[model samples]
Target chain A: MTVSLEQARIIIAQTFKKGSELGLKPLSVVVLDAGGHVQAFEREDGAAPGRFAIAHGKAYGAVMLGMAGRAQMARAEAQAYFMSAVNGAFGGAVVPVPGGILLRDDQDAVIGAVGITGDTSDNDVLAGLAGIAAAGLKAEA
Target chain B: MTVSLEQARIIIAQTFKKGSELGLKPLSVVVLDAGGHVQAFEREDGAAPGRFAIAHGKAYGAVMLGMAGRAQMARAEAQAYFMSAVNGAFGGAVVPVPGGILLRDDQDAVIGAVGITGDTSDNDVLAGLAGIAAAGLKAEA
Candidate 1:
């Protein structure tokens, strides 16, 4: 499954709208293509200074490592030292957090990822799923 | 003058569209606010590696110094040692080239800057100007 940049923009917008309407905190959202490169990102006016980097990092880690960020957090618990070294090697481009979600197609193949920030971990995850749905893209199991 | 992330994204998209219409090389465009922080950025498919850095660097320099990149190049010519040392100090975050342009408001206040890459310096400047116009913003004189 491949994701185009236009779809990525739509996903980000939808994520913002849904998150805002739900009374979630201002957010920064990032969408990456299958290759783990940024397609589009948006940070709301009141989003924190580091929100963009965190949001993009989460999506980058999910797409590059082929696992959702929350799953990576679980692994990070057991291999904290190794994960830290690896993250250092990559200049800190990964975030092991619940906001990262893999986007999929009908065939169940991963196509891209979305990362949302500025809300609780659970709410961020919900925002990612909502964005994917708004874009009409499936989510990986 | 202030540049919203929405306007920044629009400017980037317009830059790509105009560059394509002109049959230029693959391009990357970046927009930075008055504080020289990345607001929105995009790298077209097939854009060369480092294109994003160059684009962002150009805009960062423009916003940080409140001058168009061409003016910065003129300064560079007269102060090569100073330019080199400054760039070295900042790890090359400043690109003194023609592609960076300052965005202004009705009062002629500097609000943001846009940097364009992947073509001749002159064409890059033209693309930046067009993008600013497309976003309904005036270019700083």
Candidate 2:
């Protein structure tokens, strides 16, 4: 099943809460359903305008490719031209970055994804994991 | 000044609040800076997957053209070819419709725009106006 609105809201809220506890910069979070459609989003007050698009692209790429962001990052490095073409094909929605995390069901099926931005990519991933945990969901390891 | 993320959140929150008060269908709301960058966006749980894109297009059009959605609709009808060309120029971000509204400051300077979708266009406009009003912002009349 796809992520419900209530779950998406929880994901966003916990993502921000984690970011704040870590004393990171203002963050932007986006939750997308299996089809890569936005379900919910939030940008912290001091976050830059572009954070939403960046977070969206990251999560969209993860959900659309059925691959975690870290794997996509490796592939992007090894196949620059292919990754570039894919990015163009998706109208710049696929961002091969570390902050995109895939949400999975108990059956290991991807149900949605979370993307976080406005801090280091690793920190973003940490926050994303916290959000997924808060929602009682699984994230691709 | 540009629309802060706080204001953008209020606009989206109040837009959905008004939509619920009116018993409208699930809605998607998008807030954009005057430069047409997305500041905040949300789609209700039952909203169609494409609602976010549609709402974003409407608000982006209003902000980019410096005109209200009603005026844009009239121009779009009278000059279909021009409107088509403009839509292409903006990568399909322009949607001339009633739900798009320009947000203005105390001095009447355009600050941003809001777009709502998933209900009747007229109802969407009403919801958007309520949102802008709640945010203490002016709408281009």
Instruction: Find the candidate with the highest lDDT and give its number.
Output: 2
Model 2 CA lDDT for position B111? 92
Which lDDT tens digits does candidate 2 get at residues B1-141? Answer: 878878988888899999999999999998888777777788988888999888988898999989888998898889999889989998887889889999999998899999899999999999989988999999862
Instruction: Please state the error at residue A136 of candidate 2 in Å.
Output: 2.1
Q: Write the per-residue lDDT of candidate 1 for residues A18-52, one digit (tens) a residue.
A: 88778999888877777777666677776665687
TM-score of candidate 2 relative to the true fold: 0.94
How does each model score on TM-score? Answer: 0.87, 0.94
The list of candidate 1 runs beyond 4 A from truth reads A105-110
Per-residue C-alpha lDDT of model 2 across residues A24-96, encoded as one tens digit per residue: 9999999999899998888887787788889998899999999888988999999999889999999887989
Give interface RMSD (Å), model 2.
1.5
- Winning candidate number (TM-score): 2
DockQ of each: 0.42, 0.66
